[model samples]
Target: MAGAEWESLEQCLEKNLPLADLREVKRILYGKETRELHLPSGAFEAASKGDFELRGYGFEAAEEQQRRPRIVRVGLVQNRTPLPTDTPVVKQVTALHRRIEAITEVAATCGVNIICFQEAWTMPFAFCTRERLPWTEFAESAEDGPTIRFCQELARKHDMVVVSPILERDAEHGDVLWNTAVVISNSGAVLGKTRKNHIPRVGDFNESTYYMEGNLGHPVFQTQFGRIAVNICYGRHHPLNWLMYSINGAEIIFNPSATVGALSESLWPIEARNAAIANHCFTCAINRVGEERFPNEFTSGDGKKAHRDFGYFYGSSYVAAPDGSRTPGLSRNRDGLLVTELDLNLCRQMTGRYKMYARELTEAVKPNYSPNIMKE
Candidate 1:
């Protein structure tokens, strides 16, 4: 589809929801349980004129005598590389920083408490090319990398927690690389980080050539907004990855990813939504948009001819609440920001209703499984 058509469709869907009861329209198009929030007029105007798409949704839970409602607004950003993948590392990084910075400024106007970027937001999704030198150049120290420093400033300025997924270079440990996400607190302090537990070798996702499995296990960071965790990229395909984050007391889990349409588009919506329902926690699935072409041709090892680019990175970023209800996703082909307000109390409400004793079940089933295979 053309760019203009996609923008028109996005605006129509976003505007029509607030104008009328579109339950039937939503049921026919977006899922039946989807809900949207009416945002300020300035947000829509910003999206109409800016370089990115904007959307908002709100989820609520029942009131209680013991505790008040804990509403936290979250922002998920999906964007394409502003420059070509073959551009110089510094130039490419600078272009991405500018793109994300502008979108984030708009998110701050929407009063987002926490915001997350698509996986490898500072660089192109070039791992599929499997060429080492230039791609490896993108990896940097998570503690004080240029990307983290940029995000820290925005977090501090907006008083919003930021989840930044990047290719981490463990400078202290032989400069080993890991797929990691750094969590910046609202105060701009580095709360902690989580590394992707699973790596993919499927299709053109030649990720193992770049980095091995991560050393850091699932660790949740307690930010000023809420307790959250990052399940970076391929880790979303693993059920245990999601379960462990919930076990670590993560109220919200962000899955920052760089996936293409041909490989996992069908599984994209299902996994995160299912995880939220089963784990009793919120899940934000963020993916970059647009196609990224490389200088050299590469093969997927699937008997297909070599190509210069992987398939399109479908955006479709969205948030799923613990009650199995989700907000509509961002555009599949445009740079977009999805803003949603969630009640953390919904996790507790769902927990009481589901009554799935995951801890007990795991304890009872652990002995029967092989000890070596069960080791984390």
Candidate 2:
């Protein structure tokens, strides 16, 4: 079948596919809902016994029983691939290093305590080709990769926590590959790692071609500022993935992604925000900006070119707080940073002390049936 013909068929099938709840969409367009998420009393002190004020970001609450609000200034970079379309893998990595240096400098001046990079920040979104040459060669040992060392240098220099997402090559485990995130603490120590749990097999996102499902369970690292976790890329779509991080006591979760405008742009904003409010944790979504044109035309085994350009990776990176208030997103066409403040106490506010209205689309939409993904 022709590619366009297949698209038409898929669209026809999708019209009745039932993922779209028109009432919910209508409610989303017409309604104004509060986004406050609940945090049980004394959750901050309970999350950690270490002195949070020693870092110079918090203070004691007026009441002796109450802990002071923990504020973390986090910076998220929405960057474009810094190298040209035809650069060598080595040069591409070098260019990315320089780009992050510049961005992190700005973040430091703004007093950001923690910062996150976009998904696979060192490489282009070239997995659509499914060709193994230089792309596969871009993978590196997550723990000892040059990129990890590079971010560690900056982390130590700025005293900032750096979350770097990349393609990882694990030699100890049969040299298997995975999409991974490395957490570098403020003192340049490698805190730990989390592999992306979900790999997208739909359309051109065939990330499973390069790696299998992540084996490491959800982990939230204890940092100087707070407990944090990384839900790399496609994991953002799975509500359970976000819930696991929250369940593990993560106050903030950074979702580093590389998604184009043509695919799930509308859902991009809703999913992350809903997760933050639902899971009662701060959520940050960071997408790479700009279009990446691969060196050669590629085909999806379909007699025609699947895509010469992978389309624009619209970068609208933003941070959503537990209370549902969020900073405005960054630019779609430019490299940008969102340096925003987070009061971790909102995640631990006294239950029922504040009656913030959250959007209840359940009443507006039809009674839902479980999909197989949800059923199993």
Cα lDDT computed for each candidate against the true fold: 0.85, 0.76
lDDT of 1 by residue, 52-169 (tens): 7888888878889998899899999999898988789999999888888888888999999999998878888888888887999999989999999998999999999999999899
Instruction: Tell me how far the alpha carbon of residue 262 in candidate 2 is from the true structure, in angstroms, after superposition.
Output: 1.3
Q: Name the 10 consecutive residues with the lowest summed lDDT in model 2.
A: 51-60
TM-score of 2: 0.76
Model 2, which residues run further than 4 Å from truth? 1-65, 300-305, 349-376
Leading candidate by TM-score? 1
C-alpha TM-score for every candidate? 0.88, 0.76
Please name the candidate that would achieve the greatest lDDT relative to the true structure: 1
- 43: Cα error in model 2, Å: 34
- Cα lDDT tens digits, model 2, 1-376, are 1211122222344366466664354335323222222322343342223211001112111233477768787888877887876799999989889878876776676678999999988898889888888898888978889999999999999999999998999999898888999999999999999999999987678788999888999999999999999999889999879988987999999999998766767787788888888788889999887778888876654466556777677777877767555554665666776666677777753353222322233333456733335443
